[model samples]
Target: MKLTVLGCSGGIGGARSRTTSFLVDDDILLDCGTGVGDLELDALRAVDHVFVTHAHLDHIASIPLLIDSVGESRRFPLTVYGSPETLRILRSHIFNWLIWPDFTAIPNRHRPFLRLQPVKVGECVRLGERAITALPAHHTVPALGYCLDSGAGKLVYTGDTTYCKPLIAALNQTRNLRHLIVETAFPDEQHGLALASRHLSPSLLGAMLDELEVSPQVYISHLKPGVGERIMAQIACYAGRLRPRALVHGEILEF
Candidate 1:
């Protein structure tokens, strides 16, 4: 199994700064952020499932567009998985006729272009040989991290969160955890804003890392565009023994 980093920036700016999204192999997407817009039409149409982390605009921006772009050509409905609350938010806000045409109801209700699947924490959704398990995440809205088990090893993605005890405990229990992609959205100076927004600063991330029992190859993600370098420097200083590198777009990890 291969996982590709489509985008990892906290916010959009230039070509390099696209919000959180990841392409799992060719058919599955971890999030539907702006980075997905870069894909060709054929590539977009190939996406069969999207496992959402939250209802945040940055994380789900391209979902509606993705459905719209390829709905006519595809034979099967595009399935989007998220927490029940997150699915509710998408239905109430995004897929509503006012915001965007409800693809679930378009053409005909029985044969729709989109489908929503609600997944709970600790429950694993198996697709062929791969398994994606939703994990706990603390954020402004209903959110979740994910554990991708490729049968060979596990890759954990802490999708937009603050310091979460449950998430830490879950990670400790994961056997053969090879990679950890976590978010550090702010620099040390914006620690207060990070806390208020339920995002992690370098200090908070360091604290969380201290509690982690597994020694995975940590890759820092979702860094704000402007202060990313500074935040990474701070992370380097505070991360103790575990050296974490910054995640870049277009990077691929194979298991």
Candidate 2:
């Protein structure tokens, strides 16, 4: 299995900044953010399943556009998986026909272009030899992290979470964990705002990392646009022992 970082920034600014989204191989999208807009129509058509992390606009901004652009070209409905609460938020806000057309009921209910599936924590959705498992995440809204296991190695993505001990405990028990893509959306100076928004700062991230048992290659993502360098530098000072690297856009990780 391979995962491509389409966007890792908390917000967008220059060419390098595109919100949070990751493409898993050719068919699965971990989160359909603004980065999905960068893909060609052919690439967009290849996406079959989208596993959403939360209802935040930054993480799901591209979902409606993706379905609108390729709904007719695809042979099957584009399936989107999220926690029940997250799916409810999507139905109430996004696919309610006011914000965007209700693709889940478009054309006909029986033959709709989109499908939404609710996945609970600890449930693993398997496709062929690969498995995508929902993990716990603590965020302002109903949220979830995901574990992508391909039998060979496992990659865990903590999408938009704060300091969650339950997540850390789950990670400790995860075997063959090769990569952990976590988020630090603010610098150490913004600890108050970080806590208020349920995001992680450098110091908070350090505290979370101190409890990890598995030593997977940790990658820090979702840095707020302007202060990304400062956040990374602070991460170096606070969590340097783990040596978490900043996740670069367009980078690919294979397992």
Candidate 3:
């Protein structure tokens, strides 16, 4: 299976888009962002399931647009998976009539285009030939990281999180972790703000990596716009004994 970096920036700007990533062939979307519009209609249509980490706007704002774009041609209900609190925020706040039209009840409510599924922590959910297990993370709201086990190799995607014990522990359980896609949203100079917002800075991310016993190829993403250079340099400085690289849009990895 191959994973595509649809969008990986922390915020939007020139050459940088919000957070969205896709596991191709599997039809599993890690997150949906404004950048999702870049995908062709046929590509968007192929998406069967979307697993959200939390209810943050950057991560889920494009769900409404995506479903709306698919419109009448959508034959099956799009499955939206997330934690209970995350689902609640999406349903009661984002997908509710206030922020956006609730597609889950659109098209006569009986057979709507969207289906929300709440996935609890540690539970493994089937996604075609693979199984995704939800792992815990440190974020402002209820958040989760996912480990996709395809039997061939495991791929872990840490949605948006700070350095946490559970995250390190989860990575330790996997034997053949092919790729580790984590986030470092800011430079070490912004550690205070990063910690306050429950995001990782370069220094924090490096310390987190020291806990890992496995040697998965690390791909760092979610750098704030215009600061990628500074953040990347700091991350590289402390990347000793670990293989790490900054993630770019269109970067594809197969396992």
Candidate 4:
């Protein structure tokens, strides 16, 4: 199985794109963002399931476009999975036939193109051969991270969280987690703002790592473009046993 980094930036700026990632071939997407536009039509068409992290606009804004882009060619329904709150935000705020036409009800009311599935925290949902469980995250809104057990080992994504206890505990308990894609959105100087907005700076990210019982290939995502270099520099100071590296758009990893 392969995981692709479509975009992993805190905020947009030069050389940075919004947050979106996917586990392709299996046709499961992690998040949808502007970077999704970079995917080819064939890839967009192959998406059958999307596991959203939160209701944040950046994490979900590209969903509608993605559905619409493949609406005509898709033969199967596209399932969007998220927490109840996240699904509600997408329904009432995004696909309410105002911001965008409700593709969930588009084409036909009975057999719509998209289906929204509410996945609660700690619940494990099976997708083909993979078992994915939603974990809680500390964000401005109700959010979740995910732990994907792909038979080989587990993979965890700390979707846009700050110093969260539940997520930290989950990570510590994850067995054989080969990859850890955590978000470090700002430099150490902006620690106050990062904490206030439920984002991680290098210092906080280090603390989160200290709580983990196992070490994995820690790849940092969702950086704030220009400050990515500085954030990583500071992270190097205290990231013991955690192989922290910045993720670039289009990077692919296989497990």
RMSD values for the candidates in order, in angstroms, are: 0.8, 0.8, 1.3, 1.4
TM-score per prediction, in order, is: 0.98, 0.99, 0.96, 0.95
lDDT of 3 by residue, 1-255 (tens): 788888888888776565655545547788887667788888888888899988888888788888888856888899899999999988898788888888888886789989999998899998667889999999999999998887899889998999999889989988999999999998888899999999999889888899899989999988888898899888878846786888888888888
Off by over 4 Å in 1: none
Stretches > 4 Å off in candidate 3: 16-18
lDDT of candidate 2 over 1-255, digit per residue (tens): 999999998998999899999999899999988999999999999999999999999999999999999998878899999999999999999999899999998878998999999999999999899999999999999899999999999999999999998899999999999999999998888899999999999999999998988989999999999899999988888734578999999999998
**Residue by residue across 4-35, what tens digits does model 4's lDDT show?**
88788777765546556665554888988777
lDDT tens readout by residue for model 1, 78-167 = 999999999999999988999999999977889899999999999999999999999999999999999999999999999999999999
Reference-based lDDT, residue 37, model 2: 96
Number of colliding residue pairs in each model: 0, 0, 0, 0
Lowest-sum lDDT 10-residue window in model 3: 17-26
Q: Where is model 2 poorest over a 10-residue stretch in terms of lDDT?
A: 234-243
- Note the Cα lDDT for every prediction shown: 0.94, 0.94, 0.86, 0.85
Model 4 regions more than 4 Å off: 15-18
